[model samples]
Target: MAIHSPSLVELHAFLAVARVGSFRGAAEALHVTQAAVSRAVQRLEEQLGVDVFERSGAGVRLTPQGTALRRRTEKHVAALEAAALALRRPTERLRLRISVAPSFGTLWLLPRLPDFHAHHPEVALEFRQYHHEENFQREDVDLWIALKAQAHQRWPRQVAAEYLVGREIVAVCAPQRARGVASADQLLAQPLLYHSNYPDNWALWAEAAGSALPAQWRGTGFDLVLNLVEAARAGMGFAVVQRCMVEDDVAAGRLAMPVAACASTGRGYYLCRRRSLGAHPAVERFVDWLRLQCAGDRGA
Candidate 1:
């Protein structure tokens, strides 16, 4: 069955007249002449197939149907007004949704997010984290910040990618645990920490340091870099971790890079998206802002 819907203008007028109880009073509130208010209510009545109000010498009264319709229409009209206000607002005024790898987000992105917030006060950022790459097709996020090596080919592909961080992984551990990794011989002799995702890290680091550590020298596996680094900080074996991720600990003297024995890791961070949103003002501003912040790391 077909249903008739009242126009916004007429609905608003009906609501105002219903509240004010008289055409003259409603006209005063709406900043229109009483005749206009009368005409608007007349149109609203015609649209709804009923006489909504009865005009008397002193005031106006609502019919039984008009009373019920007013109750329902009041809520709907308020909601519509709010939606219209949102549509008229600026894009930068809205919040942005961003997704990223859990390890990188916890150790790196979150720490620097305050700077992004301060720089772009208009764009409120919303963060989401995942343990591994997933299909962005199912999500409605604006951007993704992925962590991988410079040569790491298995990364999210549906989004346009931009380099977000460098590929420099430093050997990090507590100040005391930093002793055994001083030389190739000592490194080969000591227990080495390993991230489950990067099983060849020990091999890669050993070759980069020109050491011949046996593949058997690798130790217990932790799936997350943060967990591996945490274990390293607590006197567990040493692991090659991103410099930026552990820079705070190194500065605080909790973790130190006694030896810079690492590879170019061919993997780095990449900012991704489902498709080119075509230089939307909000997107362009965000990308530009991110580029400026990551430029310092790129320069290094």
Candidate 2:
């Protein structure tokens, strides 16, 4: 006898009934009537020339032949359903353009991108290094991750902001530099590394340690925090930087917090998105995942 192919609808109905063990339950699951599910399964069995289910007032159970057939075909049916689902989803890849602070992108965000890609393989991300003179109105960026001072509330029109992480500045230096630094004064006696963008970081750290910045302090200044951190790691001087920026280095023992003094910089990392792109599915998924990542890191 020649074998006939079963319809996908019939196969789905059979699997649903087999899974739930009831025509009514399968109907509810498939959002069809009980009679429709029953007829579909009946047609499937007729085409196979074998009784697939043993029916009783209590419910239904797969027969030996049905069990064998289901075992062989369940995975195939699932794959087909998945393929159909893929076809139903948007065909074009979603492009998500994000602008992020340079240091944060390199030190913090880049390492965690594999996790994001594992979760959202469909989203194509393009990153631009955020700068002070970013023209959001002209740029085609969808999201921007930047540091915002507590008092700076100005945002472009059609932009919404969400706080991701707080900025806590900690004084860190090479292990050699931390050896004799027992007190805040002693720690301050050594050279200090300054970030030109935030030259008052040392003063903030001193205030947090209950010590005042000296009238004249000595140190080399760099325009970037990454350079300052490297200088400190090279034993040039102690440097004050945002905790997140140097967290990995601190954990790896490349840097040491000598004075145990940490001060809030009154600034935070903010995730801003264009209002029109707020409803985009890829944007929504990325935001949700990013928020979760930040929350987990904060708890850690």
Candidate 3:
């Protein structure tokens, strides 16, 4: 008997269904109708002369033949993806796509990006603002910068990470709001502003400074640190913020620390990237620049 070869489309449909465990899910992933996905899978099964999936009340399950086929074809799919990526970047200039936490991107990186452009004239940089919980594997991002509890832990298997900088939580307010705050206890007496994600920042800072939060403390919470900084600068309330994030505001007299106390939660920003792209020239140059920036921040 002559062997039949399955087309890439058939293989893709089979893999999608196998991975997702549903024809409906595969259709959604492939951006086609469920009937189209069913037809593709049926054609592939006919060509192979074996049932690929066992249908049951729960959903589709891959048969032994399907599992074996998947193991053999997975690498070929990955290779095709790599080739497609290479073809998409036919330009001479190195292009880098980076996804950064929103606050860091707006408050920290945006201000220093011109320097990177100045230094790396041959590189084209694209930036995306992303939340910490987003999955980078599904995105086109080549690099990411975000806060993590520990620099070494909690990364996806496909990526690698390194410590970027430590965060020091400090109590800040407008200079006017700072006028009467002679001590940590006095600072806590004012209305408190909070970051929604790090609601305990003020509480932690209070503990570190050996001060108790006042029973009548009024508070407002914001989803992003950038908004918290703005609220602090407006003299709305005292905000416990990462010192590195509000350094410029503090320096420019937009915000002031009411108490000379800070707490390090052992959490810090980290630079991350797909392990495969770790050695790419563009990624290497960007990582080097990031380290230089951190060093400069420390020196300042």
Candidate 4:
């Protein structure tokens, strides 16, 4: 005999009755009348040419064939329920996931994120702090902020990068620490803090200030620029940092430039993204806002 497909309504009713062991219970669960549940089950039984349920003093019990069919139908019903639930849910919003250096994320990007949200409320932004180079194969990251040198040298062919802003290195210390320091040599004589990654920052700044470093110059080293800034503010030592990073601290009197000289490293921050997403609207808005921020920094 040829097999026939059973209607979803009949299959649903049969599974409900098999689970509850009665048409009345199934009707209550399905929010339908008992007669409707009975007819649906009966239709399924007739199509299959087998008795699916047998009435007893206890109510009703599924036959062996019914039990086997119920097991298969349960999976189908669950899948259908899941599909219906998914369809009923609200549509997901677009998210722009970004990866950036920890220092930049904390000191620069985070402060300006609220402005982006205020202007573009519909787009969601997510930031991940990363210290290493970008991996294009990672699907989670839509964009990255990296050092200009690293961006130029290491960016993959699948990605593109644009220069954001070059940094002006300045020597900073707590107000008390700067009170007596009149010259670069005097500032260098005191305890100096340095970023571990940029060991030559102080040397470069000294060159720009037309001052010579004392032989065997050394200082405390921190892996992150943020930590170095904090140490300087706490009077742990004088720190040579990017001007942009400490602009607010200087204005707030938490830190002071020991010397008025600033040096340009020729290195800068770069905004990078996958080439495929170069024209994406969300990416464009963020990049435009970032450029405006950078331009404002230059004007400052």
As a whole number from 0 to 100, the lDDT of residue 93 in candidate 1 is 40
Please name the candidate that would achieve the greatest TM-score relative to the true structure. 2
Writing each residue's lDDT as its tens digit, candidate 1 over 1-300 gives 786888877887788889988876776555456677778888888888899887789788888998988988899788877676457557544557788787788877778778877877877677766536466664557777876543847544345576777476767778887664668667557667778878776777778888776745648789888898898888876777766678778888988877766676778778876643322345555778788767865664
C-alpha lDDT of candidate 1 relative to the true structure:
0.73
Model 2 pairs in collision: none
Model 3, poorest ten-residue lDDT window?
Answer: 84-93
The local lDDT score (0 to 100) that residue 111 gets in candidate 4 is: 84
Poorest 10 consecutive residues by lDDT, candidate 4: 85-94
Cα lDDT for residue 65, candidate 4: 91
| TM-score for each candidate, following the candidate numbering | 0.64, 0.66, 0.66, 0.65
Worst 10 residues of 2 by lDDT: 273-282
- Report the lDDT tens digits of candidate 4 across residue range 33-77: 678888998899899999988888889999999998998789988
**Model 2 error, position 122 (Å):** 2.7
Backbone clashes in model 4, listed as residue pairs: none
Q: What 10-residue stretch in candidate 1 is worst by lDDT? A: 275-284
| Better candidate by lDDT, 1 or 4 | 4
Query: How many pairs of residues collide in each model?
Result: 9, 0, 0, 0
Overall lDDT per candidate, in order of appearance? 0.73, 0.81, 0.81, 0.80
TM-score of 2: 0.66
